[model samples]
Target: MYGVSTYALHSLPLPAALEQIAELTDYVEVMDDGCHYIESAEPLLSYDLRYSIHAPSRSVNIASTLEPIREASVRVIEDCFSIAAEVDADVVVHPGYFAWAADRERAKRQFARSLAHLSAAAEERSVRYAVENMAWEFFFLQTPDELPLPDGAGFALDVGHAHIMGCLPAFLQVPIDHIHIHDNDGTADTHSAIGSGTIDFAAVMATVGQNGITPVIEVEGIDAVRSSISAIRPYL
Candidate 1:
């Protein structure tokens, strides 16, 4: 029912994107630091955009074999949480990634440790955050049977990523609080419109309806994102 993810138009510069947010939507997802730095400024900027933070995706990792990277990941999330505090936003973050490593147990441990650290940081500031189910990543929380979620944790069901992860229903079984709806091809992750790709919209929407989860569909550019929102408007 809400508009598209602002991350769809992330290629734009921060100020330009802020201007677009000023013109286009009310609930803007401040998906990266560029947006955060602008939105988190003091003296109250002119923008009326209500925000939610999505943690940045970079070379940093919470599930890293190196302690420094893990520490860096924690620091990055702390920065995100700080920005959330500044904007009074709910921060959303992917737990961690384990690429090229087939070690599930090690990944699980790293994710747990990272969540534990960030969870404390989030609570100290009383800023809310959600754990997202990422595609083809090393996080155990993607699949239901893979890892256990912490008590205070929430879920973000990325539909496109779920298709790639092969765990939509399993993820649904968990107590989902929010959803990241998108479409993509079977082999590659393309954030397309709902019906434009291979994802089953009817079944997924049905499952979401049955479970009472509302979705925020993600897409590419502003026009395509608007079209996807229009397409799903009737159902919502």
Candidate 2:
């Protein structure tokens, strides 16, 4: 699954966007970070492109302390599902982010409830629900053992984020059905291409092998993203 985040394809016409990366990859993630295909596929989305949707993020966390923001998160995910259905893509969702880590306990409860809502909506749309683990967040799908992840609930691991949080061990343990591959400086989320940072790329691959998991790289822009894939190709 050599998929690049379409956030990398920002602002280009849909056909031009698809043509730009067509030769380098096969799958794509329709990130709400930049592009909007609300009215039509333009041209690229018109193709039989395999897709995955990264839900709207940033301050749109489902675990917000405020009720309105939390509800908004659900509607946002619902919109993502509608788009996924249009593109025939699976959906990748972040349960939501908390502004402060202290709210983690309450956020956990909120996430559980939110997931239930998302799960039902997703099931109806036939969209896959992949919850992502973050680099700096209140809590992760903290443990694989904790959740009642029905038949379809899966995980999207962010490897560089794992290294940042110093959760390498736990990161290796989760059932990785999907991933957000990127690199970051220890101090911040740099989103640099793989091998540009201090992470042990080979060790990360070995861990993936050990766990029988395959994770796609989460990157920005096509040129840099293509390079990152090459850098990690040997291990992959």
Candidate 3:
């Protein structure tokens, strides 16, 4: 089955977005930021659908060189884990970025430490998390060559991000625990409808089938989400 992300209706209130998305798919990945920031599991209990959370990434940087910021980032995600546990939802997390090219090594060390802490936190909560490969050069884990993930962390592949990084083909060969599907011109992260961009959804769907995973349709608007669902249905 395919899933949809609240990113498509991020302008709406969380409850309202979830209500509308429920009409489209039984699986939903809540983009836990902006209007949908999940403070608790209370808002999610009303839904009969399956869930996965795209953890709050804005202002969160597990790779910060500053000790306090790194600690705070881990805590933010730990808070997200607590809610995910209640909903039995796996979370998607961005691998943090470095501020400067010179700080890359230090940032890598910090990210490793954060992952170790998050692993323990997630284990305690009985929830899983997948560290997503990023779209930009400053972010860590932009390619499969960066594996194996530390602390037994799972991989959440964003096909659009991979395409922008020009590594989608390599990513498809790796084992993916979760996936976010969207199309974009090779240059920008537009999150367009499936058929409107350059990504070959046929190959993407073939990999999804082989991996036995549900691909979350993470487009920009409700209309695009609907189009993407229709575009992808043939492969399902």
Best by lDDT: 3
TM-score of decoy 2 = 0.83
Better of 1 and 2 by TM-score: 1
Q: Which segments of candidate 2 are over 4 A away from where they belong?
A: 11-15, 37-44, 100-103, 137-152, 207-214
Instruction: Give the per-residue lDDT digits (tens) of candidate 3, residues 124-229.
Output: 9999999999888799999889987999899999999999999999999999999999999999999999999999899999999999999999999999999999
Off by over 4 Å in 1: 33-45, 99-103, 137-139, 206-214
Best-first order by TM-score: 3, 1, 2
Q: Estimate each model's TM-score.
A: 0.86, 0.83, 0.98
Model 2 residue 204 CA deviation in Å: 2.9
- Superposed on all Cα atoms, the candidates' RMSDs to the truth, in angstroms, are 2.7, 3.0, 0.7
Q: List the residue pairs that clash in candidate 2.
A: 181-218
- Write down the lDDT that model 3 would get: 0.94
Tell me how candidate 2 scores on lDDT.
0.70
> What lDDT tens digits, residue by residue, belong to model 2 across residues 1-236?
35777666667755666666667677766666544454343443666667776777754777776778888888888877877777777777775656677877787677777788888888888787688766564655544454445446677777777677777566666567776677777667777788888777787777677766545666666777888888878976
Please report the TM-score between candidate 1 and the true structure: 0.86
Report lDDT per candidate. 0.70, 0.70, 0.94
lDDT of 1 by residue, 115-192 (tens): 888889988998887887776645555566654577476677777877887776666666666677777776677887
